[model samples]
Target: METVFLKKGEDRRLRIGHLWVFSNEIDTKRSPLGSFAPGQSVLVADCGGRPLGTGYVNPASLIAVRMVSRKADEVLDASLLHRRLSDALALRERMFRTPFYRLCHGEGDFLPGLVADRHGDHVVCQITTAGMDAHTDELLSVLDSLLHPSSILLDNNVASRDLEGLERFQRVASGDVPEEISVEENGMSYAVPLKNGQKTGWFYDQRVNRAALTPFVQAQQGCSVLDAFCYAGGFGALAAKNGAGKVTFMDASAHALSYAKRNAEQFGTETELLQGDALTLLADLRREGRTFDIVCLDPPAFIKRKKDAKQGLEAYQRVNEIGLDLVRPGGMLMTCSCSHHLEADALRGLVTRAAGKRRRHARLLFQGFQGPDHPIHPAMPETAYLKTFLFHLPE
Candidate 1:
């Protein structure tokens, strides 16, 4: 019932259905941000008194308001939350044979700041924004009604929570889930560490991208593979499955290497697991005269914010150079960047620059992105973050 007014000529983007309202665009003189509490629902409008839509206000965040609905009367109540959860669940049900994919992809699923990753009967839900954080119980109620899953996890420990004026903690909302859970991805099963593993215990976004590496590995039956920053061997496991004769995985976490070893042994592949920094391992491998027919540089996002663009690009530059050095002439180079701040073409450009510096030419073969489970919002570029590219390095 409260109203938040935007500055003069600041509602054009909203008119085109864009969902975010930045703090600077608000008119403090007329409708002050201090007037509303964080995560409070408000009817957003243009300075001319024209209603734009309904959204949640977060004065503390740079993203001041996240529009949840375009209708003036719409309220993000239990009913609306139920419908959104059901709609997302229905899509996942139609997409996967088992309920193991990302059920809700934040704004991509039209529910900004909310994520739910389904692991069989156990579902892990993450709330990143103050708006969504306030509605945690309502969101959990919807999930319970829709799936009646064995357990629900509130995986809310992320840095973004701090920016949204929220506290981070992981707690069970229903039933009981374990510290470690089993997951199946692209025909490979992994015993994911739920208590400590990265991002919802799995990176389901790379599902299709890893599957795309199958034929490439199959073509080189006796070739070697180096999965750098390979957390639990998502790509390496696939390469082994596709008949890569020798596979090497490198990760900073010894715990993750243990899981990778388990997966490699299960597949009966010749595998080597190295526990150390990926960049350091790459240097040591080069020093030890190691080269692979295939190298996958699937490192974590180097760029988290816009201001870090310069530093992130430099980090990517260094990593790509190291990855290229590890790849044999005529080998395959698959590199990825999950920073939404960097576009796909820019990733290709970084790879090209790295290759050019080393006199290695890159013949780009394929471009990949997050799987269907992580849908991209056309209106929000932030939703389209994952970028993967397969290149052939010239001799």
Candidate 2:
């Protein structure tokens, strides 16, 4: 009901489809920051009092306002949330064979700061912003009205909430959430803990990328396969099932290795799980002169922020070199980075540099991206984050 008048030229970004409004762009003279509370809906207007849209306000954060609707009269309420949730659900139902996938991808779904990962009858929802956090009850009601899920677990234990001056906590919004849930991807079922697993129980974005490794693994039957930073052995298990032999999984988490072993055994395949720092393990493997026919480097974001670019780029180069060293001549390399700041070209360039250092020629097999569950917003380049590249290195 309140109005947020932007500075004379501050509406340019909004006009270009950008949804964020920084604290500095507000016309504080006309609209005092202290007058509005966090998560409070307000009408956004231009310099001449022309209505731009509607969104929620967060005075304590740098991204003071996030546009929720482009329509001048659209309000932030249950009706709006229902439409967004329904639209997100409709698209996922059409794309996936089952209900297990990312149901809502925050800003990508136009519901900024809210994410929902659907695990069949159970759903894990995360609200990272003051706006969505304020509508917890309404969101749960709407979700129940649509899918009528058995459980709606609110996994709000993320660091980003702190930036908005909001404390983080996790609880079941409705119904009882089991400790572990089964999610099927690419015809294989994986058990992930709802409360303890990383990033909404599983990295559904890499589902397609894992499938991409199958044909390559099928081509090299009974060949050695290495999965670096292999959490739960998604790539390794898929490769093994597709005919890769002597599969090895490396991860820092002993618990993750346990799950990885289970997933491998479930498919009647024997896997060697190594627990340690990935880089150190790679160094030790290289010292032992071990090589693999297929290598997957699916590491976490080396570059989380812009300031970490220099160091992160160096780390990417080092990891690629280690992965290349572990791959036999003419072997395949599946390298992925979830860092939004790392561009596809930059990742390829790093791989090229690593191969050049060894005097090996690199041939790109194919470029892969996150599955359709994680849709990209045309206006937000940041939404297009995941990059998976399959390469062949010739000695």
Candidate 3:
């Protein structure tokens, strides 16, 4: 393999276990990036020519190299993919009784740019980077061998693919893609639209956080819930399964609300489905003096890129302010942020400030994160993205 030498001192993060190598860090004098083809596997080395590891290089992307293995000779092949799948599956099996969790979590599972979420006998994989996209066949073979999944859906329609200079499209790699798939979580069943659904059809990362809502729902008699940004009604379904008296499903997408309504129907829970912008609907609800026993705010990433941090924080504050306003005295508020740019401390502080604006006493009941399936790489903070906070408003 050709060698891609990093500038002196640029190998520090990689040596400490980070998987990404920025474009500017490369020693272009020794190994010009333009000379290598996209997704070309290369041996990374320091300026002195000492080998660092093996990874695939993408000349067009900011993350020029994503190290696959620490060994110089190791390559991302069928053997390596098989071993990584086995290890990731082993951990998930130990953590969950059902085969309904994220099987591969990009860099978290040490397989950068590849995410595979298993939904029963079906596995939906997202290959975001050109490097992983080049190994689609090997990935499919490894997944099939490991799980024998009836279908392997490739949901490559993501914005990140554009950054990698890869075309975005969705296709079934193995068996015929099903219209929908069912999976049990927190003793509740959800009908996930695998083909047209968002983000692998389900967000398994929020599994633990959704499960944490049981006790809160059970403790309140005739509980009312507002599942804001309710995708497929995961949160509202859980509340309904636990005997919530009234559950409102709200989202901007009519497509998402269709499945959320179906899931609610399956749960035999009478729900009010509101289709509109979350902020607008939330404000209307507040104006109508509508209050609930539990209000869940699981909005999409407000801060996608670093530059959007300021505007995203303001957006978060506005939405959360309305969320807090809709919570009655002695009620619960569950808010979440999937933005890696927004830290847990910042979320907590923002929520605190939101509550203070109403002169309400807020007690943080629980702090939650992505489930074990979405393991956080010790050296990569980006891997630990999801943050959840459950707060109680005292009377």
Candidate 4:
């Protein structure tokens, strides 16, 4: 195996358990990064030539090295893949009652750049790293032999592939994938469009947060509810099924609205699906003097890049303020942010600022992270990104 030597003081992150080794940190004079091929396993050593760990080197990317195993003697092979997959499945079985959940959550599960989500007998896998991409055949074989998933769908359409110098494509890696699959969450059924849906067809990360809204929802029975950015009607359908008098789902995607309608129909709940931009729709609702008993704000990542942090935070504050304004006095507001760039404290501050701007006293009733299916790595704070907070508006 080849070796990539780091300069003095450059292995600090690796020692501290952070997996990424940037290209700039390498000792180019001793071993030029250009010589290494993408996804090639190499022995990483410190300045004194002491072995550090076994990792894959991607010279074309900024994240030059992604640690595969800390054990010096460990080899990256089929046996290792089997062990990692089994360990990941064990954790999921212990945490989730149903088989439908995030089976793997990238670095959080100690398998960097690999995500596996299971929906019944089907498994949707996404490989976001060159290292994982290089091992697709091994991964597929292992998954087939071990899980025997009815099908394995590759949803590798993420833009992150560009940064890794990879081309993005989607295909069924093994077996046959059905047109649509149903997965139940918190007693609600949803039809997931795996072949052409967002982020593996469903947002399983919000399962716990959506379940947490049951209490607030039950309390507001027979009251009108507004579910903004209601993808597939997870929140809106839940509210309606929980006995909300009525539910209105607003989103910019017509396809998402269609899925939301289908979900509502499956639950036999009456829902009003509106297709449009959330911010514009909210403004119109406020102008029309519309007020809902429960308003849910589950928008997409407002801050995708670090440079957009400021403007994105402002956008969050604005939407949250609109959501608060649309709620009747003493109503409930369930707001969420999936932006890893925005910390929980910063999001709380945004909500506080929104409440102050609206001149309404907001009392936080509940706060939560992503569902148990998406476990957080102690060393990788970025893995724990989702934040949902429920608030009570003063009457």
Taking every candidate in turn, the Cα RMSD to the unseen true structure, in Å, is 1.2, 1.3, 0.9, 1.3
TM-score, candidate number 4: 0.97
lDDT of 2 by residue, 236-347 (tens): 8777678866789999998888877787777667689889999889989999999999999999999998999999988888898889889999898999999999999999
The regions of model 2 sitting more than 4 angstroms off are none
Top lDDT model: 3
Which tens-of-lDDT digit does each residue in 212-236 have in candidate 3? Answer: 9889898885699999999999899
For candidate 4, what is the lDDT?
Answer: 0.86
- The residue pairs found clashing in candidate 4 are none
Which pairs, if any, clash in model 2?
Answer: none
User: Which 10-residue span in candidate 4 carries the lowest summed lDDT?
Assistant: 262-271
Error of 4 at 204 (Å): 0.9
TM-scores, each model vs. reference: 0.97, 0.97, 0.98, 0.97
Q: Candidate 1: misplaced stretches above 4 Å?
A: none
